[model samples]
Target: MQDNSPAQPAVDLRGVVKRFGTMTAVDHLDLTIRSGEFFTMLGASGCGKTTTLRLIAGFELPTEGQILISGQDVSDIPAYQRPVHTVFQSYALFPHLTILDNVAFPLRVRRLPRAEQRARAMAALEMVQMGRYGDRKPSQLSGGQQQRVALARALVNEPTVLLLDEPLGALDLKLRKEMQLELKDMQRRLGITFVFVTHDQEEALTLSDRIALMQGGRIVQLDTPANLYNAPQSLYAAEFIGETNLIPARMVSADHGSSVVEALGQTYRAEGTTASAGAAVTLALRPERVRREPAGTGPVGELVEIDFIGTDLRLTYRMADGSKVIVRQQNSGGIPPAIGERMPLGFETDSLRIFTS
Candidate 1:
């Protein structure tokens, strides 16, 4: 008989909750990370992203619920017994040891043969492109190089899953971007499940196959980067992922997949809604989705301010009610509307996301 069932998730958190004295860090979170998937936990500081990572790492035990790895109940297991390794923001390498010895430290502690340790450690270094620096001391390498060595050390044991706790946060911006590409490539090539934690939304969008955006100790939204950005289910999800214009609106009517909302003294057809007729709602419109139309063609506003952002122009418009709406257009080297000039704004039907206030 052929087994057609889905494989077990590399890591799973079932009804997980973590409390710190009077505060709850993770509030009954149920999450499953599939094998070889790049899953990211994303949120601001104190949003429980890091706390969730620690719970999975066994550094912090959950106050309630079960933690599983490879379909096994590991809620009671200690960190050393878990089939996972964590790479922290700070590359915790021993300065006294050479790169090779640092990578071999884990195998050494496991009491593998000296030759086997050396061979495995060297292979791990090569995997991260730091093989040539095997003999160099940690102090002799640059920050990026040191981070690569640290990654090699973590990977040397070949754990089923790799937990990265903002491992690229310590690097400079340019280097961090470079490492992001490399990390994604490495994950794909090695086919290892990566459970990454980061507060940086851009980083999460760039590196994750799926992201869980957490807020107040719960996942506000969990989806692919594009869906999280384009089809945000809540105001928090829309506002957190990128720049958005929150227009005060009132729901006019609603159906299964669409809704009509009134905003800026005009009616608009918006994507899915959770509000009923005449209820107060909010419209989340991304700046880039806004179109500039001739004055009086659509919802009219006066251009109030303009800023030249590289590759794009950020324009602020003042509605009659004095509320401001921001619009972003690509820099095509054309003359922009003068400040104080009146212009109409256009929105595609799919661009407006309506949420109940």
Candidate 2:
């Protein structure tokens, strides 16, 4: 079989491992990020997402294996020589300099002609829609505006890959959402590779073309947002990517298509993987996919709490097994169930995901 990988990945890590003394910061990891792709490395704290980004940026040297950029081995290259730029969360613009000078600093360091540096800086600021504010100092701008200047500084060089280490972490919730949309738009327009490191699952889902969910210094699952959310391969993926109700079950049978599982003393069919008959498994179900009907129809639960979010109503129920089942219902203008009433909860077979425990 001819290996039909990319002709040259924008960034490739082959069995790369980085250890700080006795502790392994990055386990043996192999990854390939394609050109012009917005790839996010998402995980909890101490999961090695940032370390992997540093390895790609040549900030940290790997103890074993090789790193490649565009098919060339760059394991020995220094950070200054690498065709990559990093945007940290701190928005590290020079406080004493104007926005234009801050963005032009990179070009000036290379000894480019003064005119060219100024033109490039102005163009970069224009790209971020901060051209009119070029004369303002960093202290005069808001947090969002300062971050935009930092983005312009990173873009001025037109690097092959831009590594962002939680660049939106410092912003508030409302501004974070706005910046998420802006960053996505910017990446699509620029068409350059983006390796974003974030521990926030929603941020990864909102911004990435694909997400690499890392755990304990290794990638646990790699897929598009929809795939990772809809058809998770493992229990960890189902729990980590979103809110999931993991119900203990016993597998009755499984094939290439679906599996028959028995849960809460009820028989149900679920999407199958490698689970076989008589094996202990768990069924992953999302809240939005479930519905509540009259009592005596399905799994019975008592309505515990109801939250009136603007667009939807979130209902929490106490299941027969003492587990809480949450249901998200759109505002259809119909009166919801009484707070103390017992109701039956039902969901479709297609939404059930099975994983061996």
Name the best candidate (by lDDT): 1
Q: Which residue pairs in model 1 clash with each other? A: none
What does candidate 1's lDDT look like per residue over 247-308, in tens digits? 89998988667788889889988886667799999999999988888854578889989999
Per-candidate Cα lDDT values, in order, are 0.91, 0.89
In terms of lDDT, the poorest run of 10 residues in model 2 is 1-10
Best by TM-score: 1
How big is the positional error of residue 16 in model 2, measured in Å on the Cα after superposition? 0.8
Q: What TM-score does each of the candidates earn?
A: 0.95, 0.94
Pairs that collide, model 2: none
Local accuracy of candidate 2 as per-residue lDDT tens digits, 1-357: 113545677899999999999989899999989878899999999999999999998989999989988778899999998989989789888999999999999999999999999999999999889999989999999989999999999989999999999999999999999999999999999988899999999999999988999998999999999998998888888999988888888999886666788887788888856576889988889888888877446788889999998788888998888878888889898886779888888877798988888
